[model samples]
Target: TSNAEKELPDAFLRRCVFHFIEFPEKDLMARIVRVHHPDLDQKLLDQTLQAFYSLRDIDGLRKRPSTSELIDWIAVLRRAGIASVELEAGMPFLGALLKREQDLLVFAEA
Candidate 1:
């Protein structure tokens, strides 16, 4: 109580509220992908998600691609008739996943 009083004024604290949100699970993410691309082959969906998650794990990305970005990327892949969802195959269509030039360059150099 003393620490809280010392660090924060009562007036300021009165306006604050806490909420918890659990990270979306893999199954949820998969469902998001499916919703965006219902006609996408199951194997391709799985492979693309694996690659997308792998990209998120890379260090120093200015911004990691979101599930929405993944959907767009998959759409791009389908439009280009890319069957395999490997890193190399998806490289050309990276614009869908990464919106910033720095992020794209960082990924390219990585």
Candidate 2:
């Protein structure tokens, strides 16, 4: 359950069983997103997922945004009435996904 396994004591780690989960692929992610935002526009959802995966692929991100952040970012975009065209042009509500200042700068550079 811990993201920082290296920070835990060796003795503590020995007592625990680890199971790592990979990030969901696009189709799987779409289904997960629909569970949260059933009425989201398909085009917007597609664009959002594309941008989300791209962001995750960026190297040297301090804290890569996770599934929960993706959901929150999409919610903000929908509520703010952002268009899919705008999302395609550039990411909106980026702060909702990227929390670190350095990470945002890294993403901007990318």
Candidate 3:
């Protein structure tokens, strides 16, 4: 009985985490570019490249695309620029992630 009651808090917390992950379901065709602050590190950009290579080495399916994810992906896609629907869209794309402007700030650092 002690174990059973203790498990509820853990179970509830886990579900809360999962819900956060899936919330604000992405708009798959949205195009985006990330305008990092001018002082933003080249290293962060470099790290983003490393992450992209890892994804290409792993993805085995046609997948839904979100705006920020697409911007990262264009690097991996490289000179084969024709591969990006987001690039074809060509405006400075940021996804409609916000129900309000407040939503855009999640990615921004103070």
lDDT (0 to 1) per candidate:
0.77, 0.91, 0.35
- Residue 35 in model 2: lDDT: 100
Q: Each model's number of backbone clashes?
A: 0, 0, 1
Order the candidate numbers by TM-score, best to worst. 2, 1, 3
Which scores greater on lDDT, model 1 or model 3? 1
> Taking the tens digit of each residue's C-alpha lDDT, what string does model 3 give over 1-110?
12322455776566554322331222222211234223323443344334333333433322323344645444434433333334333312233222224433432321
Estimate the lDDT of model 1: 0.77
Best by TM-score: 2
What lDDT would candidate 3 get against the real structure?
0.35
**Best lDDT among the predictions, by candidate number:** 2
**TM-score for model 1?**
0.72
TM-score of each: 0.72, 0.88, 0.26
Worst 10 residues of 1 by lDDT: 1-10
Residue-wise lDDT of candidate 1 within 1-110, one digit each (tens)?
21322577778769877556564567788888888788888888787878888788889887788878888898988998887645455565888888889888888887
Instruction: Give the C-alpha lDDT of model 2.
Output: 0.91
* lDDT digits (tens) for residues 1-110 of candidate 2: 66542588789889999888888999999999999999999999999999999899999898888999999999999889998888877887899999989998999899
Off by over 4 Å in 2: 10-16
